[model samples]
Target: MTPEGTGRALVVGGGYAGLVTARVLADRFDEVTVLEQDHVTAAPEHRRGTPQSRHPHALLARGADLLEGLFPGLRAELREAGAPVSDFGQFPMLYPAGWSPRVRTGLALQTFSRPLLEAAIRRRVLAHPRVRLLDRTRAERVVLNDARDRVIGVRTTGDALRPADLVVVTTGRNSRLPAGLSTAGLPAPDVLRVDGKLSYTSRVYRRDTASPPDWQASLQATLAPTARRGGTVVALEDDRWLVCLFGADGQSAPTDPAGFAAYADSLANPHIKDVVTRAEPLGSIYRYGGLGGQWRRYDRIRPWPGGLAVLGDALCVLNPLYGHGMTVAVQQAVLLARELDAHGPADACARFQRRSARTLLLPWYLSTSLDLGWRPEGASVQALLARRYLARLLRRIPDDPELYRRFLAVQHMTASPLTLLVPSARGPSARARRGGERS
Candidate 1:
């Protein structure tokens, strides 16, 4: 059925990015629909779509702000649902620069599991008037038009063609978009990975203590210096807690509970193990690996499909270690809205792709730069320099409060990447900047 006005806009993938993008489309198009292969559930539970959802996830202050703007009262609703609020100041955080001195200042990092967060956002998106959510619906293929430059719609298993004015793919990292769309005579994007042979394993535990999980913040880990690692605690509803421990390439988190505990103990700090040992066990350990950074330049080709664009993991998959994947998705949605507001549908897809790439380039480079640091086996010259610079900055961070605060601000996406290179604490000053920091 043709949607009135400009026709229906369909977003494939029900992850954070897909949901946000679909809402943005609803504003520009007559109607918007979101498609997901896995069954979407209202209650917080693990699902097949996001195997990584089992891990603890945090909504950074930057991402939280974007999300709140997109869907009002979201944060409050989450809090009411038992998602704990963290000031980041009080939250123990051991940056590579040593302990961040648990001061009562810093951006807010809301704590919760991926499933819980997704479920919450899904509910909010479903409430939108112009949005239709179709769960357990797999997008079989991209229905290409005569010119093959733009995808007109998606082919569903129902042997039906669900045509639309625009299609946004958010199928995520395991996406087969490249191969699926290659039949149209366009070559796929070249794969670039920093797979330090990394694998991830996570589990949730019931805690008897009233205080929230703290071990995640106390570890001093960075991508460049050594084989990197991390852990986090997300206070869930009902006084429960979700704990996730990650080890960098080759330093995989074990699948067995006992082995996982051992890996945590071996981290720079023993706090993670201490918390795990004390917290009551909730579920068996769930392990997921093959986590790598990937980017698909669907818009890079000479002619991208006019009515189709990809979002989220379908476009750029970041190293989850940076915790910016979800944030990127939300930001991309916001970008899509801006582009549509400025241009007509005929040229919007191409513009959206370029804009989408711009949104991801810096963060993607930043994330991979660090990933290169962790894997000594494949260290690049540039990666080494970044590693050195980051290491040096961390060593001086604790002693230099201004420096430390500025770094945290940028790391939290509160400030621009240029903040590190500025000479004037405020801006360009009489003195030139050094390494993007105030000289």
Candidate 2:
């Protein structure tokens, strides 16, 4: 195997994960080629490749910071494109209990449609002299050496073989890499899945800048069981509001105009309903369903091949309800860069896969533990307890500003989860204990 920074690199899938991965590889590889199945355009529009791009997306604080580092001045660019930035606390969120207190937490949140962000990142990544993008090119499978110990390159759908020293797969949730691996006589990774039977119905509306709403963005978070219906209203570029109403456990929102408005009215919070009633619809409503959390244990495979690494949703896919998918993908790309620097190209593939699994533990736990609540029969005792604790924490967030701030910090992956475990002096539990002492 060649040393790091001295070989050719190939990335399959030129979406968000693939684009970011290519940018990172350009720093170390002599050339980075990205194979995209869709005919990617320079403009910001939804493509057939990513059906979910029509929905709302959150670039959390940590992800924003990492992306800005990777593509310098990206935040400014997005802002210039009219994407609004707000503090975490300023965003109004209606939890299961009630409306969370709005206070300045300093953690930043930038809201935009998925297509806009992807297009912006794609432009920057393609501008790198070492990176090359091939639109409408589909990768069929990885080519291995005679010993089947290392990946030599990838075979395209057109029966063409492209040689590379390293091949990274970022093919998102519906990846075909496993079938190809099995064909090569390699063990497929074990899969763990927890389905909440969630679905999202989204639509874009013209925001009236002349008569702006009280809040820039708002969320009615889904609480399992009784409160399966939820919604969110986020301000996007071009004076548009991206509204998404989601339901869990087969309570999907309707796509028809009248029915869609009715579903919005039925949500626990009225913010989404207000938007639908006031704003003018931009286009047809779109629905994407059958969502679930899936984790492919690629790191657990023994005798893993060299010159191969799986990333993003290809490795682990979280339910989009939590808005962690994009952030986690970006974080994995950052980890890939670090691993390449530490282990070099010859040995980094396997090590990066293992470390990426570790990095996914927190986001996986957060998404699945809450999702398991929809089907209590499938939840273990530990998952049930964690859900109960989180439910209680949500109730406290309305009254305790500090606790709410910490909760947002953890949710955005900016702070450690341990921060949520520490009790605030102003918290109800602490106050109850102090009352007993005073008595």
Candidate 3:
């Protein structure tokens, strides 16, 4: 196959990651097909495959920027669709140390449910001339060449075979790619698991009109290891708020209404309880319990098969509290585009995986460090010390707006984690200096 638009590309799954991957592949492939197991909705409705779509989801500033770049006027379209946009730093936030002062950092976060965002992206991607979405179709295995050295296509159920020059896997956390590789007589990537044992219950509520006019949302983060419970109430498109109450270890927010309220009341901050007490319920409480960080060592898998690549949760699943999953997926999609631009489809798999490892390292470290607190056997001194330093930084955020800005930048995936570890022109305090030494 040639480097430019003359070959077929098959993307497994049609979630946010797969949809974006298809959009990226469409620029280089003559034909691109997205095989999704679940029936995708035309509108933003919950599907059986994605129960977590009912929970609160926010697209970080960086992710929003990339999406807009990929699909022109997307931000404007989302705004027209009633998704509210707020400055990242101006939200009503309650960190471990009191409230964060509102500061206009110029970074904007568009708040909405995952289903709406995925649906919007799906609509846009499936509209392309070269792109086709095969919903309710399962990609069972990868078809390899005679030597078993190159993936030539994918096999679906019903004995259907779709030939492709490149195959991108974005089947999400529960992906069976390892088994598929093993079944193809290939070396399946080794797996690494970090169980946070995190659980949460989420529900939608009608936004209260009586609230302060400037109040857009409230984010109260839990200080892990010390306080295991936290929650957030975010404004959605339809004058509704998505409230999610979370706990680490074995403490799960109950699905029952009364117990849910009690969990909210137990949070260190009052905003969660306030929303639960004042807002009218719009939906039943839904709970999701499987929250863990898992990474497949595809980069470490030497002699990686040609024409095969992995992205999104299939590559690494992070704890959702950091909200890095979608953003990381977007970053990986961009990386895939860059790799394809430089190397084409045949040799892009290993190069893309190697380069994307840099993209996954920081967020993986951040989420796992906090999550390891729940599992003593997996916890390390380095992780504990990193958590302590972060806790101190959070405590100082109310006093230092610049620090909060830097932290926000890192949180949004715009800046490196070193921005938090190293101080700026303001110079480092005794504590920050010590934190740097520790880091």
Candidate 4:
């Protein structure tokens, strides 16, 4: 059936990215339908399609801001639902530069399980009159026109044909968009991958102590080359802590309780070890691995289908350690809405894809650069130099609160990456700046 004013827009996948896409589409299109392979649950539990949701997920400051803009009262609603709020500086983060300088940076971080966040967004999107969420319905391929120049709709697993004027694929890392394009007699996009061999083991614990800890959250990232183990302890709703132990380059976090604790103990930060051993256990350890960063260069496809666009992981799957994946997806959704409004439907798909490539460049570079360091075969010279520079910057963060705040700004997606490269207290003197000369 043709929609009210604009034609129907079909979204493949019902994850956070897909939900956000659908939510945006509802404003531009007459109707938006979301197709998911697994059942979408209202409970704060992982769906079959989202195994990694079991781990602690960080919603960056920019992500929270954009989400609140899209869904008003979202921050208050989430807080009411038990998602805790904390300032970014409240977290005692141990980077290669020792512990992060704890100071109120004024940036807020919304900490919660992935399932809760996804469910919340799903409810809002599905509640829209123009949006219909079809869970347990898997999209098999994108149907193309007779000339194979544009997408007409999608073909589902149940022999169902969903015809639409626009199609956005947010199916994520396991997306079959490339295969579907190939099946439709189109050239598949090239894939760029960095195999970090990353693995993580997570478990929930009950924080029953009457006295609260000094820190709200703790993150310890393994320094490359010398260290390959890291861990994070994030406070969750209902007085719980979600602790994750991770490793890269063959140092895998074990699923066994004893092994998990041992791995946490190996981390440079003693806080992670203390929380893991002291907190009362709530759930069995869940092991997740084989998460290598991969990006489909769909933007490079010449004569791209006019009505087809890919978002989120389907386009660029970053290493989750950076905690920017969700933020990037929401940003893309906002970009899509703006592109559609400005360009209209005629060229929105192609324009959005091209613009998305630009949007992901910084986050992609930042994430992959770190993942490149996990290579036992040694990183590229450029990556090595970049890492060294970052290490130097990290060393001075403790002594300089302003520098830490700036760095946190970038990490939280509120500042540009160039901010971190600026001269810190250890750099040139005030006199040197006046003379425009190097130290």
Candidate number with greatest lDDT:
2
In every candidate, how many clashes are there? Answer: 8, 0, 0, 0
**Lowest summed-lDDT stretch of 10 residues in model 1?**
430-439
Candidate 4, 1-439: lDDT as tens digits: 1124488899999999999999889987888999999986777778878888888788788988899999998888878987777888877777664566657988997788888788788888888999998889999989999998888899999777899988999998989889988988889999988777788889999986498777678887765656688888888877889999878887888899998888887776776888887889998999888778888988898888888889998898888888889999999999988878777665788888888998788787776776676662566787667666766666676567678889889888899988887766743222321211110
Error of 4 at 131 (Å): 0.8
**Global lDDT of each candidate:** 0.71, 0.86, 0.82, 0.82
After superposing candidate 3 on the true structure, give the runs of residues whose Cα lies further than 4 Å from its correct spot: 1-4, 209-213, 376-381, 424-439
Q: Tell me, what's the RMSD of every candidate?
A: 5.7, 4.6, 4.6, 5.6
Deviation in Å, model 4, residue 25 alpha carbon: 0.6
Model 1, 1-439: lDDT tens digits are: 1223467888988887888887677767788888888887788777788888877566667888999998889888888877677666555545554554334455876676677677888887788788988888988888888878767888877877998877888888888778877866777876667664456677777765556444324343545456467765556666676667776756667888888888777665445666677777888898778777888777677777777777888788787766788888888888877766676566777888888888777677677776776565757787777757766666665455456567767767788878777543422221222211210
Residue 115 lDDT in candidate 2? 86
Which pairs, if any, clash in model 1?
A: 149-305, 150-305, 150-306, 420-436, 420-437, 421-436, 421-437, 422-436
Which scores higher on lDDT, 2 or 4? Answer: 2
lDDT of 3 by residue, 1-86 (tens): 34457788999988889999998888888999999999877998888877778887777788888888999998888888878888
TM-score of each: 0.89, 0.95, 0.93, 0.93
